[model samples]
Target: MSKTLPPAPWTRRDDLARLVAALGIENVRWVGGAVRDTLLDIEVKDIDAATPLLPDEVMARCKEADIRTVPTGIDHGTITAILPTGPVEVTTLRKDVSTDGRRATVAFASEWRDDAARRDFTINALYAHPDTLEIEDYFGGIDDLAARRVRFIGDAHQRIREDHLRILRYFRFQARFGAELDETAEAACAELAETLKGLSRERVAMELLSLLSLPDPSETVARMHRLGVLPVVLPECCKKGVEALKASIETERRESEAPDPIRRLAALLPALRPVAETVAARLRLSRQQRERLTCAAERNEGDVADPRALAYTESRECAIDRLLLQGASTTPLRGWDIPQLPMKGGEIVQRGIATGPEVARTLRAVEARWIAEGFPDRQRVEAILQEFLQKRS
Candidate 1:
């Protein structure tokens, strides 16, 4: 069965048209996520084309067409064509010849079916003709797409054995597209969960972060936890964390807040500095991400009802993250609006206070008082400063 993709901006681009014309329409077709997403009515970000042409041939054709080409993954048969709209990745059809449960050694193939067979999931094994927009489902990808099912293309265990990262990809795709778990895939993942340890921390971190970024990852994560995959990947993730994540997701929906991966991650683990630090280090997160995670975890442990106090210690964004995470906890936090300090350091200095550490100390003291008094009028703040000056004199 074939379906036509509605006219999209990408379909109307001259560069894409020229490339398709140059490569010969039959030799190239849109494949992978772009096709899957278009079929799902989701916005497609990157356009990936599969071709029977070799890497050098692709490069030569692009050069002849005067289209900018970057050999982004040349050895692996990928070239990035810089179209007017954006970069489109084109890859020569390939089949895996060797596998070690962590990586694959592949040999270039001219058959589109072979390429489709090598893909991890049925929904991803789809292809569409460049000109007619006719989809070609070598597997039952169309049926799976219609059902919103995330199932491996062929044997679930074999696909996972070829690349252990597919275990995480399974959950990520399920979170992104499926409404429920595919039992066979789940069972395969459970059997192969230990193989996930062989994957690089960077790869695991990226996949986990992507999973956490979904609209609501609680259900998928709970499924992963039930299958024991979470323990293999992140031993620190606990039952309390899962519950907290569900609550945090609910609060986000109720409040219409943006999805935050770090906050969600913090909610999935104990709100302790050491736990956050350990998770950050294990995932090889950046310094800024590590610091923010630690701050959110630390702030979630104590009283964060006073926005002024939280803002004084942490930035507004950090305070909000802390509040959201803490809100998911069993303890009730005081609800308060973030307030701005009425006085500046220079203003305090002009009041006869020294411009050194003394001025900084006085500003903090006055700010504390203003917060304690619930941010009073400017006259009251002035009176407080004057009193300080008189006492110092």
Candidate 2:
């Protein structure tokens, strides 16, 4: 009951496999994305092994080999076993103990059948032995993977109730599979769409962003919206910026040089106010990705043309963002870099006859005038400041 391993540039290494076998964990198989990607002819990113070994036993064996052991999800019977080449996620087979639409409560199982039955979809349930290269498809996952159909493992509504995030994952799989959504699965998603709101914003945001990067994100996004999912995660997903981003993803896809996920999200920013950034901050995007999202959002306001006008608007990042939306290569903001102000509040105070708002007003007027004149070098800029100050005096 074994199969030959596929020819991948990267395969599970021998040293780790030998160690795991030395532990005597039965029913060892490479499972999940690693197997699915191998079938899709996509490069394998990482390896995860399912075993019947107890968590403590796996830990003991790893310790014996001097392999780095981490309780990545010890509560769920998963251990992160690190090897020199790469890290492997080793987990015991488990069945769900309970679920409340957001997450599952699981108890480790003794057999592969029990474990495979609890998975979300059929295509993901396929497992492969890294060494013997044996594939175990308990749910006909190999056939489904070959056919590109993303059929749920069991009752669609039951699966959604177990984990609402599966609703988004369903769409992502559809994109990855390049297959039409199964009729039953689509209906079940619509029936339970409202329950998706119960999921965490971070989870929803991650899934939605991934969904948008798919070949036909527009189809999935519009479908999710129709089924009442997008609004709960991002109320702004329906705005002009969102549509623009959707269009941009397709345009970029056509170019044969697809942008990475962050750039794709950069194109899909919801047309939002500065306030929306507060929501983004709350959603917990990475600092760099958040900055990109914020930069794009800030530039969403209005167009910039004049050099001095750029002074009133945003920074170089934002200015460049607006120019990108216009299909331009560079921004006018780069065309004129506004130097730091030479005149200080103290200088203004020394020239001021009062401590009222008028001093501020006069300085702004002078600065605006100078910008309109095309900000000269440091010396000319200083001269312009002096002229304004003299007038104020």
Candidate 3:
């Protein structure tokens, strides 16, 4: 790996160049994930920098440079500078004054090493000069990155005590980038696994979903289960959930589909609607996410055989999830757009079914027949409606 921040498209942007110049190249260094990922040659999604200047000073510098600034986390000593390329988050160097395993109070400092020490993982504490692109290592972050190791900055137990969410974050980073788990870190995470319950459900859900989104997280997740971490966070996940997740990944790869976190979560859970719903609620998932998860949990034993019918009856998205979980083929649904029922209740009323409950019932009957007939054309829907009307008469 290069000793300096590797050149990438984001690094080559003219707007970023101006922003860096405005922030004073000597006063700022690219920090955190941007620096870590640049070294690892991964796709960098967000840019972050650390500066010795206070948040107000950072904002003032951006203003002088004619750059828009957002007080994204000003209380935490951070400001976001918006450039033509995108927003770059610049935070004043800070050392934790106090921590309660949830939030930290910090005082801004002028030393980069102080900020680095406050970070959770050594690999994430790397800093890179914007102009020189030279790397700065206060801890052996570069070496840790080279070793594919994800370890805490100082004491693993102390780090976990400072923020309970780091327990889940450890496994998530390991799943994505680690070749071998640091034994000390693993032990600390295991010992402090229960502390994870103290963290917010939203934070836990975010980390879990990110882990599940990875190409293959089965091994890492299984390791977490062995360490009792999974039991503490998600006792609802079945003992066989890891195997199901592996199966789900293989099925997704076979079908050439992207890995979906919610669907994979459905695989990890017991195939029961209530169980899925309960887990979703516990995780505080969005309404759409909850619906998809519960829908995937539905028992559709014989339904995967007719992909279209399954899609029509229980949504294309849910049907795809069920088929993937069942290890069935999703080829039939490729480019097969789901269609409407092709008939309306108003049209049925116009056909003299009376504008009452009869019309609604008659419409539903027609829809059921239409769905059974594979969602035929409007003419076929008309014929189905006529059959229902005749029966009602």
Report the number of the highest-TM-score candidate: 3
Please write out the lDDT profile of model 1 over residues 176-222, one tens digit for every residue. 99975689999999999999999999999999999999999999898
- Expressed as tens digits, the lDDT of each residue in 1-393 for candidate 2 is 113458565564676666566565355777888888887888787888888888998999878877778999998999988777788889999999999987788988988889899999988888776566677888877777777789899899999999999988998888778465588998888888788778888898788778766655766666666776666666655656556666665555444334445445555554454644765675777787677676665553345455235544455555545445444434354456657655555555676547668768766766676666665555765577678767655
Candidate 3: worst 10 consecutive residues by lDDT? 299-308
What is the model-wide C-alpha lDDT for candidate 1?
0.85
Pairs clashing within candidate 2? 3-133, 3-134
* List of clashing residue pairs for candidate 3: none
Compute each candidate's TM-score over C-alphas.
0.91, 0.78, 0.96
Taken over the whole model, the C-alpha lDDT of each candidate is 0.85, 0.71, 0.89
Q: Alpha carbon lDDT of residue 41, candidate 2?
A: 81
Where is model 3 more than 4 Å wrong at Cα? 390-393
- Of models 1 and 3, which has the larger TM-score? 3
Model 2 C-alpha RMSD vs. true structure (Å) is 4.6
In the order shown, what is each candidate's alpha-carbon RMSD?
A: 3.2, 4.6, 1.5
Ranked candidates (lDDT, high to low) = 3, 1, 2
RMSD value for candidate 3: 1.5
